[model samples]
Target chain A: MEANIAVSSEKKPTWGGGGVRPFGASYGKMMMWFFIVSDALTFSGFLAAYGLTRFKFIDSWPIADEVFTHIPFIHGEFPMYYVAFMTFILIFSSVTMVLAVDAGHKMNKKKVTWYLFATIIGGLIFVGSQAWEWKTFIKGSYGAVKTTDGKILQFVNESGKQIALSDFVVGDRGDDKVTQTRKNGLWFESGESVGQYSVAQVISSYNANPSIQIRSEKIDLDTKQKIILSREKGAAELAKAKLVVEGANLEVNEYGNTIFADFFFFITGFHGFHVFSGIVINIIIFFNVILGTYERRGHYEMVEKVGLYWHFVDLVWVFVFTFFYLV
Target chain B: MAHAHDNSNVKRIWMVFGLLSVVTIVEVALGIVKPDFLHLNGIGTSWLNWIFIILTLVKAYYITWTFMHMEGEKTWFRRAVVWTAVFLIIYLVTLLLIEGGYLFETLAPLVRW
Candidate 1:
């Protein structure tokens, strides 16, 4: 490669060749920039397609706030505060990543290692938090009905207050609520597991209730949002009508439209995957630092490159947070 | 070209990050509150989105210009990459919008998937 470049240089003048180093850095940095641009386009395509779907389902689209409700330790329900916290963690990690690069500039191995370690831990924590969120989401707190036409209808009381499925779920099935099963029932004696709640149970419960009336895509008279029954049904019906249905008119979703779930999983999942890779990369770089790779090389460009990647993750999050949580 | 930035330049990066954080917090608050004026008719296509897009662009600009050091690069070098990206993005958005409009038309019956 060096001989080729030397021969090519000896042959003729190529464009703007002003003492440019053949393979020192300029090409790598340019390549990274191109990669970032193309990657950004890929993400934009995903997000834009999401917007297209969202716009199509304007009326039936899931509310971002209501869908992603989980308060770290508080448990029961809180709006998007946990996600906000996660965003902060990621942004903070980006800060530490930058600091690592800064330490690299000073050839401060100890400081660089410390910051890189913190960044890795931060990335891991963010991934863990996202996993926890997915757990809560998949194992939905409250239950809703899956319509025959493939839409989810959540349960709200006569007072129009959202209620948890736990409030209505009956005596222990001991592991009956399962989605995927073995080919043969007797193939494996599956251990008793309190499986994730089902949308079907809510429908049957509502059907059995004498006072309970079904709420369709149409809105209730008073509250405007869909409810299990009319306000006139009152508390008596609310108590006896132990079923609630929720969700929207889309493919299949744990909560609402499958598109919402799809976008949620795809965007966050991709971001989480990036974080995981970032940690792995940081670990490799961390070991390199310990072994004095940069000290011997007399340059910390590797740290800077990794820092760019880390900040790029945070940059993606900034958009995800806006689209998913805000807009 | 070989010059190295000092502590003050690094401090400037921190300042930019601080500004970005502040803007993000404001975005969160707006999202949560969703003021009556913002939602007076409905939250669809309001001034808030404008604020968000503008602020987001500002943050992106700072991240690229400051942290990525695009501002320090040769004019032609910066333009070669940045302008291509900008134009390509605009072109893609246009295509998506047109395609989306067509899809919307067909989706009323075929939209179940």
Candidate 2:
């Protein structure tokens, strides 16, 4: 009885210090899994919020195809192409990462180093592509006029092809309104950078160009296209214009709904940030392999742990691709 | 120590890669084409959207199972991670969607342009 009590006392009060890796897993690996579970919930929160807003604006949601139609130097419209390329890049990087982990298990340091290098390169390319996509989204192709009720009004040619602001608005600032700047004692510093032309210019150009028609944000479910106003209704709707919105910002977006842009920026930006951090962590582990740290320690479990994180990132992208781009 | 699992997992990794790549290509094609029948035929949700969701789940399954080596983990640990996340996500999404549909049904009419 005395001997039993001595052993029990030595191991008493081991309440919480994280050696409790359930299922005989290492402490580091189990903790990584915990962090991943929590982070997954965080992303789910954002995606569910997006679903809420989408449902609220179901009738007038912007079509993903119409909004994200741009690739560098290519002229014509090819929607979802660039986003699909990005998805492939991330997936390929994930493959390389898994290979690294597999190599690590066999204690093949050279293969692990090379595969980790490829994964890092893939991550950098994905991040760069996202930056490009954001640029294209913020600088919209076809400018739209905002109604007093804060809805977008786009211009379509007679044949139903969308046209840009510079296409028909050829005159120099037709409106006599002075440009607002700090030097001129204008107190409107709270606004985004001043647009090139005034609302009057867009209005006058739209009025003079009889070949153009107004496309409202509302959709016709049967045809799944934006409802275009007739010639007479077009003129009347143009009169309701309050401002000329060229590109996307918090205040306005040329796309059908401003909330679409907001969600796009937030969700994609957060995912990209995660990818960026994963790249950094992989680089740290890669150096450790070259320095023979894992060799001395007798295992390459660090690579395996980091691989879990990399695959988690790719898993998140799969959902993002489905919801954001595909559906 | 001779590891219990084979070190020749390179083949399995490539097979998973091929599967993921093929699935992604199919998804991108469907998105671009958006066939009329699939786009229109559903009780409340479109058939095309359902297909996309199902395919995405399949891809997610493989990624989690093979790439992350979840299949090699203990059964209890795997269930602990997957089940908790799935249940919570579904619960939250269902409630939020209900509230959103209510707003659209009741409040959208009141806010006139």
Candidate 3:
């Protein structure tokens, strides 16, 4: 023992082990913060790119209210209600996560387990809600016609109320035009969208219904509304119709610009993935808590580390909500 | 660690949650109603958009400070993370938005995009 003491006394002191931690942070905690900082920059790059695209297409960007006015089960228009609920759920989860950290600090295993469990549940629910939103967005509500110049043309009634192509276009096109695959004849094909109403059917049905007017994708900046063409102009524009577009895809969008859908999917998809991984990490830590790992280790710094990440996700959501939904 | 045994920890968490909820509700209300003056006036966008952005920043602040426990960290530590992020993000956003605006001004007149 005297030999060991002499050896320890002869050793040089390290920074953290000697209680000389720079910034009063443990090495692990400091590293986690650094990771968060870099992760935050990645998200900022995406959001700023989104902003850039939005600014570029400011005039024709889809009105958010018109696109995201969905609430499951309870039909009818409730703009921002569902998303607001989602925001509350995420914030509540964040609260639970912070509570878990607080409980961990007190070394109360039971409270920590309960709070962490609640946090996981909240995360699962949020992810599920996001999936539902994506489904609705992908399936779309109304369909539109694409012109030769790639302009999307939708329909509104005489009173300027938006109408779907299905609202008036008789489903049966009464023609037997099969999809042209690459093997059919030419070396290439247009990759025609099958099982959809043809442009001719939509245009003919549109002409038959005089009450329907064409709404252009272009928004009048001063009004912030899609431009509704006059009946004559609507007929003229209908003559330029090439294909029918429904829902959203990389090449087309029923909700105005395709880039809008791209950013929506990309940004929210990335955030959702973070939430998912956070849940997995939370589960592992929850098991650790049950096993008394932190209690045995003398500190619940792991819980605190994960808590920082959970809150960071919530923080990003706040900005995403503002930019994508509200602004 | 200092607040470990203190009952104030739970109280602070709930208080911040309440504040965040109220702000979100106010934002939703404003978004739904969308007063004409707020939507119509402003230079680049509108007053309503500015309000949303500012309120979003406020929410971000609370989430970072209290929920993320950033305020509890040493001052220099917090600065190293926050200042670095804020500066970089602001620089990128300003330049990208300006570039996007320039493109809009130049290309929009010629092409429909």
Give the distance in Å from residue A259's predicted Cα in candidate 3 to where it truly belongs.
0.8
Where does the lowest 10-residue lDDT sum fall in candidate 3 chain B? B1-10
Q: After superposition, how far is residue A294 of candidate 3 from its true place, in Å?
A: 0.7
From the highest lDDT down, the ranking of the candidates is: 3, 2, 1
Give per-model TM-scores. Answer: 0.80, 0.92, 0.92
Worst 10 residues of 2 chain A by lDDT: A9-18
Scoring model 3 with DockQ, what do you get? 0.76
User: Which model, 1 or 2, shows the larger lDDT?
Assistant: 2
The C-alpha stretches of model 2 lying farther than 4 A from their native spots are: A1-21, A176-192, B1-8, B111-113
lDDT of 2 by residue, A301-327 (tens): 999999999999999999988888888
Query: In model 3, which regions exceed 4 Å deviation?
Result: A1-20, A178-193
Winner on lDDT (2 vs 3): 3
**Per-residue error at A320 for model 3, in Å?**
0.9
lDDT: worst 10-residue window of model 3 chain A: A5-14
Q: lDDT at B85 for candidate 3? A: 93
Q: Rate the local accuracy (lDDT) of all candidates.
A: 0.68, 0.87, 0.88
Best DockQ goes to which candidate? 3
Candidates ranked by DockQ: 3, 2, 1
